[model samples]
Target: MSDDGRIATDGIAERECGEPQREPPCEFCHIAAGDEPAARLYADEQTVAFLDRQPAVTGHTLIVPRAHEGELFHLDAAATAAVFETVQTMTDALEAALEPDGFSVFYTSGPLVGTVEHAHVHLVPRFEDDSVSLALSRRRLGESDASELVSAIREYC
Candidate 1:
C-alpha cells in the first residue's frame, strides 16, 4: 500500500549508490524520496518516473534514478539499467495516454547542458506542428576531425 503515487518496492533500494549524497538535497532526490511534491507516475526500487513540473511539451515525464547521481556517466550499471527501463516504461505510457505523433526522449549530462544536477531522462510527447525543437546545430566534420574525435572518445572507454 503506497500513497503519493509511488509504487511499492520491497525495500530492495537499500543498497548504497556510492555517490556522496548532495548537501542541499537535489530536487529530484527529494521527489524520489517522496519528500517533495510531484505528479508521480511510477516508482521501483531504483528509479522513479514523474510528470515534469516545467514541461517542454504535454505529457513530459522524467525518469530518474532514486540514488543521486549528478550525471549520466556517474551512474553504475544497475542504476543505468533501472533508469533506462523506467524511460522505456514512461515512453510507452506517454505514447498510449497522449497518442502524440512522435516523442522526444533525451538527457543532458552536465551543468552546461542540463539545468539540474541530478541525472534524469526526459520523455516528451511530440505532436505535429509542436513548437518545441530538440534539434541541435548540424555540422559536417572533416575526415581527420571525425576520426580524431572517435579515437579520443575510445581512449577513455
Candidate 2:
C-alpha cells in the first residue's frame, strides 16, 4: 500500500487516483481495456463481464475487475464490490436467458490461480445432466478442529 492509498499486487499498483493501470501481457486486462477480443456481455467503469472462451457450460461467463490483480484478496473495497455486483447481474441475466437449473460461481486465486494472472470470477450455469461436475471430496472435522480453524482465520480478519 502506498501513502496515497493505492493497493499494489503482483508488483503493480491498481486503483490509482487517476487512470487505472493495465498489464500488456495480461489478456484479461487487454480484454477489459478493449485491446483484445472478447465476447463481452456487460461492462462498467470498474468491471467487465463476458463469455468464457473455454466454457464449462452453455452459459459460462466471466466477470473481472477493470484493473489488474492476480487475486481477489489484493483488490480494494470498491473493486471487490464492483466484481461481485457484476457477478450478480450476470447471474440474473443467465438465469433469464438460459434458464439453467442452478449456477456454479467460483474464482481461482493464490496457488490455484489460472494461467491468466488477472483475477476473474466464473459463472457456470448448471443443468440437471450436464457433463460438467464440480463435486469435491468431503471430510468431517472434529468440533475442536473446526473451532481452531475458525479462530486461526479470524486472527487475520
Candidate 3:
C-alpha cells in the first residue's frame, strides 16, 4: 500500500483520499485485491462488501465489484447485477444488526457527485435523528421544463 493508504496495484499507487496517480489503482480495487485492510462485511466471486472508514453513520457499508470499474455505466449487466445482489444482502444484515429507523442505498457515478473514482454502492444506516442528511434540494419544475427534461433523458435510455 502507498503511504497515503491507497493500495499499490497494477503498477499504480492510490492516495488516501481516493485520488490516483499515474493511472493508479482505485481504492476499491485495492481493497478488493486484499492490498489494503478494511473491515470486511461480505464477499463473493464478483462482489465485496466492507465497512466504510469514513462512514456517514455507524453502520455505513460500501459494496463494490471485484473488477476495477470506475463508473456505474462502465459495468456490464452481470457485474451490475452481482453488485446489487451483494447490496441486498448487506442491507438485510445491516437492518438485523443495527435496526435503524430507515436505510439509504445510493450510488455515486462521477467525480462531481462521488469522491472515489471506483464505482461503489453505499448502504447508509439511518436513525430517526441522525446527523447525516442525504436529502436533495426540492424544486417544482414547470410542465414544459419537466417535459423537455424527460424527453432529453429518454433519448439516451
| Top candidate by lDDT | 2
- For residue 24, model 3's alpha carbon misses the true position, in angstroms, by 2.3
What tens-digit string does per-residue lDDT give for candidate 3 at 1-157?
7666668888676666665543544678778867789999999999989999999889999999987777866889999999999988998999999998888999976768887778889999999888998779999899999999999999999
Clashing pairs in 3: none
- List, residue by residue over 1-157, the lDDT tens digit for candidate 1: 2333333355312214333334444789889988799999999999999999988888989999988777876889988988898888888888888899988888887668887888989888999978998778988899999999999999999
**Regions of candidate 3 where Cα sits further than 4 Å from its true position:** 1-23
Worst 10 residues of 2 by lDDT: 16-25
The better candidate by TM-score, 2 or 3, is 2
Candidate 1 residue pairs in clash (backbone atoms < 3 Å) = none
TM-scores for candidates 1 onward, in order: 0.82, 0.83, 0.82
Order the candidate numbers by lDDT, best to worst: 2, 3, 1
The residue-level lDDT of candidate 1 at 98 comes to 87
